[model samples]
Target chain A: MNRKLISDQDLVNLYVSGQESALEELVGRHKSKIYTSIYLLVKDSYLAEDIFQDTFIKVINTLKAGKYNEEGKFLPWVLRIAHNLVIDHFRKEKRTPIVTNTDGFDIFEVLGFVEESIEDKMLREQGHNELRRLIQLLPEEQKEVLIMRHYGDLSFKEIADLTNVSINTALGRMRYALNNLRKMMNQKEYSYRQAM
Target chain B: MVQTFTQNDIIKALYHELPASEMVHLEEQLENDTEIQNNFEDLNVLKLKLDSLVLEPSMSVISSILDYSRSYKK
Candidate 1:
């Protein structure tokens, strides 16, 4: 069977029907995104790695025990597990200020390696840095919406459902986030133009 | 009447969270309003830049996860 042709739902069904390989394939498909999401919250590579594994273990137990219902999308279900684990990790450690930029995990530097065009790449690098700085400045609500919507590729409706806010509230936060970014960009540009 | 939409309205339209009727109205406005069009483009660029910021987890993290998954059956 062409693994590429296998939809998430099909793979999930296969796993539920007792095919081990199907479970493996599903994990292969989604592990990075899940791990990255958790890591973003926890900000510790070793701890993130451990929680990533635990997430899969929990998924396996849930699926094998026949307790897994395909209520929402599979990815979000997996992500919610990871999110809960990160939250638990924080509770256990009593860590304040989840996700600090103290280490060298500058989002801009990581993204800089992925761009192709020279000028576009440079602009993207600059944009990445500026965006990161701007995101750090946003209030927590707006920041969470931006991360969940953009990084998680979650629909606004899904985000609202996850965050337990109204759909309009989720949309409003994203709006506020963008408007804030635009304002910051204009201010920065004006300052730069004046400097030149 | 050339009623002006605010930045928030443009953001809502960009995300496709607007109602169908309002979406059509916004699209029509975007066709003629350069400022709105510019804002749309900037929002788009910002979204792409943000999307590109996502980093894949290291290969070792993936391997550990697979190993951990396999251990569940043992």
Candidate 2:
């Protein structure tokens, strides 16, 4: 069947009705967003992986028990689960999560790289690494809204509801996030030229 | 140029979430207003860059998730 044409709700229904591949399709369709959202928040690959698995485990159980009721809203629902799991981990660790690469873990280690020449690959990787670090420099609230809207594919209204802020507040956070990222990129380019 | 639009409105329109009525007027103003056009262009560039920053978990992690789902197959 043409799974790409299938809606998330249809995929969920198929998976619940004994089609295992449907579940795989669902995960494949959203793994990047789901995993990246988790990773960006926790800033740890191992913890992110664990929370991702746990999030899906909950999704599996909920689906099997016939309680998967968030029709037409699968990705955001899963994101909320992953978001709560990240929060739970932080609460248990008794430490606030910071948006710095203090641990210096290379997230690209687990990230997928596209086909490119050796030189091209290095340049792309460097670019991606720099952008990822810039994202880490954003404030936590701005980072959260950016990740939800950009990576989680949630609308501003959905983000506002999830983050318990007004839609305008969510939009403001996203604006700040993008503006900050743009400023950082420009500053980096300027410094590069100055050094050259 | 008849209505005042905020940066947030440009962002909303960029993400395709601005209401249709406002979008019609926003498009009109985008053609006439240089400042709004520039703001929209800058934000759009940033948005495109962000969109390219997708990352996926390792295959092992995906396998574990699939296995957990199969184990509880009803």
Candidate 3:
């Protein structure tokens, strides 16, 4: 706690110096973002939480084995570890578990036209839930790029390298992702455009 | 609808991938181009919607991870 002003790398150094609480601080700093990133991808809270645990476990093991050389950017590294684990889980299951076309993502479908008089708080929550569902409806690659760039907080270059694609391809995926989401929004007014 | 920058160009602009002059040009053009402006809004809204949905794992999850990591070894 005395080293509150130090960087993640410094925390790592502290942990390396037999201060177990340093690891706790590092995990505390990153747990929310990291958890949300995995949850968005996996779409199953339980599995995402499991992967979250496994990710930090991997981090702990690697660091204990004296392998984490990156300083100051622990979250990205933690995210990379989580991302790969999610990919691996899907591959082993022989299907992308997160891809679903269910109507569960829509407000009208879920809550059936709430009165305009409803509290703004509840309305906002529903709106967020709807958007979250819509995100789940995106195609696998697009959704991956969206989550990595937006939630995982990686740049397109990092996303490109992580997915083994060209930078243009990564950027293109993001572009199409935005387009698809807009079309999904206008689904009632116009048919969705097929991606090229 | 006017076509100003390509979709990739708009993306680059939105995500700050464009260089300074290109970004300035895109902004200037978007000011006069409704089509490009709409496209920018679409992309911006998508990013906003996704960014707004912050999912937190439960406290039980936090406890489990903490316990696991503490006991975990190389």
Candidate 4:
């Protein structure tokens, strides 16, 4: 079967019908974005991995139980589950996102879809770590909105609904996120220029 | 109208989050406002930097998920 041509909805249908490889194909298709979304919020590689597993577990159970009603919104649905799980985790722990107060958290090793070897991919990814590091500098609200919009591909309205904020509030968080990133970039560029 | 237009408006316009009416209004303002244009350009640059990143889950975690999914049918 050409899994390449299968839509997510089609894959879901297959999984619900007892074709397990379809679910694997579906997970392989989305793991990067979905896992990244979870990691960004939790900021712990171990915890993120656990949550990632749990997200898929919940996905499987939901499908098996015939509760998966999202016809074309599978990614967002899974993402929402992951997002809610992260929120629930923090709520139970009575702690906020670790990056919100921490100075530096280790950037977990990333295995991207590029065809390069692991060493080459790591070397290449190191160049872009600064952006991720600066993104970690954003306030929690701003970072949440930015990640949901950028990585999850959720629109501002969807983000507002998911976060239970007004549309303007979601938009405002993104605005502030970009504004802060610009400020950080300017400062970094200034320091580099001064050193030059 | 241009005088009252703030950074949030420019960000909204840049991200395509602005409504049609506000978008039309902002487009008129952006036509002549160099500062607003500059800010929008900077935000676009930041967005580009962010696009370079792709955070993948750990291989072990993916394996765990696969294993869990396989065992889940019982």
Candidate 5:
């Protein structure tokens, strides 16, 4: 999946040349990742959906108005815009809504059912639920790093630059995140074994 | 220094983010240290566990974003 085939720079050129499909392609390529990032943070399907739209609308206007420079990095730039908007949404609402875990909606659970081995699939699903629960318990810094690295597919260096931290610091947060999750899982397993 | 490594160190090594010298040293230790190797395996399992938890956005969200973007046509 060479999703980068249509480079951001090329997309910008196409948009500037009045190629509307170019804009559509750019949005199509990145909509999922962008929406996921927003959704993770805001935890509201409707609001996250709104911000996702607004992010691209802002992108379109910026590009059309000769404001978007071809800086060779599009996703992060757009993400930053989306991030800021989400922050604004929280500010206007004056209260951050609690993120409810919708039933039968987790992508991993759906993927788990597709696995051939029922026992292995069950283990994977259990581990995933435990991990998700553990992640919510993580400190803000660690949670952000895990989300960006795993979900957003950003490199540690990119994440460091985005979050204004040293690469080692970013790496360290991810380290802590995994370590904490492992400990949590172990503790959970011990309890389950004792019960059994 | 007896070169004590923590769970975090194991994760850094797993992600290939450790400094080259530290990575080399860790690799050498893993070759000879069963405990460290076990920790590495545990970290791998932990990472897979974490990776599996990502939920896909709803289909309505996807369609809404596309529709929202299209509404800006001048």
Candidate 6:
């Protein structure tokens, strides 16, 4: 069976019916978006990994218990699960996300290996890290909208519903997020030119 | 009827979330509107940059999840 031809709902059904690889395909298809969403929210690779695992654990339990009900919306559903897990974590810790590097763990260090030239890898890493920093700087509401729309691939309606805001509010937040990122990127470029 | 488009509408168009009829209007407006064109171009570039920023967890984490799935069969 062509995996691409199968829908997320089908994959969920297959997994529920005892096809193990179906779950693999589903997770593999969404791991990047899911992980990055969590990482951006928590801003720590270790905590992100923990929450990612817990998110899947909840997914597996829910599916195994025959409780999967969000038809044709697996990604959004899983993203919601991960988002809740991140919230639970923060609630337990009793603090908002902090940008800390004292753990000596580089979030990028845990990226899955890929074949690329050293120069290409360095350039890609630099650009991605820079973007990540800018994303981290966004105000919480704007950042959440940006991540859900851009990475989670959630539609504005879905985002509004998930975030308890109106669709226009979600769109407005996204607009702000992109504009803020653009300003920061341009400022960085200007600073680099000045230094050179 | 003349329809006005907001930056938010352009964003919805960027994400393909606009209604088809509104998309047609937005496209038509884009042909004559430099301001909207510039905003769209800037947002599109940033969106592309964002799309390329995919990050993945390590193989070990994936393995752990997979192994748990296998051993904890429903």
Candidate 5 lands at a TM-score of 0.75
TM-score of structure candidate 6 = 0.93
The best candidate by DockQ is 2
lDDT of 5 at A102: 58
Q: List the residue pairs that clash in candidate 4.
A: none
For B1-74, candidate 4 gives per-residue lDDT tens digits of 24457666776676677788888877777778888777777778777667666666766777777787778754
TM-score of predicted chain B versus true chain B for each candidate: 0.71, 0.89, 0.70, 0.73, 0.71, 0.92
- What TM-score, over all chains together, does every model reach? 0.79, 0.93, 0.80, 0.82, 0.75, 0.93
Candidate 1, A46-164: lDDT as tens digits: 67777877888888888777788875478888887877787787788896445455543432135336437899777765665566667777777887777676665577888889889
| Candidate 3 C-alpha RMSD relative to the actual structure | 6.0
- Candidate 3 on A43-147: residue-level lDDT in tens? 766677789888987888888888988777788888999999998998899986645434223222222234655586577776777677777888889988988
CA-lDDT, candidates in order: 0.72, 0.87, 0.77, 0.80, 0.71, 0.88
Worst 10 residues of 6 chain A by lDDT: A101-110
Residue pairs clashing in model 2 are: none
Segments of candidate 6 deviating more than 4 angstroms:
A100-117
Report the lDDT of model 3 for residue A125: 71
**3 or 4, which is superior by TM-score?**
4
Model 1, runs deviating above 4 Å: A104-130, A194-196, B1-9, B17-22
- Candidate 6, residues A1-196: lDDT per residue as tens digits? 8987899999999999999999889989999999888888998888888999999999999998999889999999999999999989999999988764343134455344478889987887778778888998999999999999898999999999999999999999999999999999999999999999
Q: How does residue A38 of candidate 3 score in lDDT?
A: 87
Pick by lDDT: 1 or 2, better one: 2
**Cα deviation of A22, candidate 1, in Å:** 3.0
**Regions more than 4 Å wrong, model 5:** A1-4, A96-99, A102-129, B1-13, B16-26, B67-74
Of the two candidates 1 and 3, the one with more favorable TM-score, higher being better, is 3
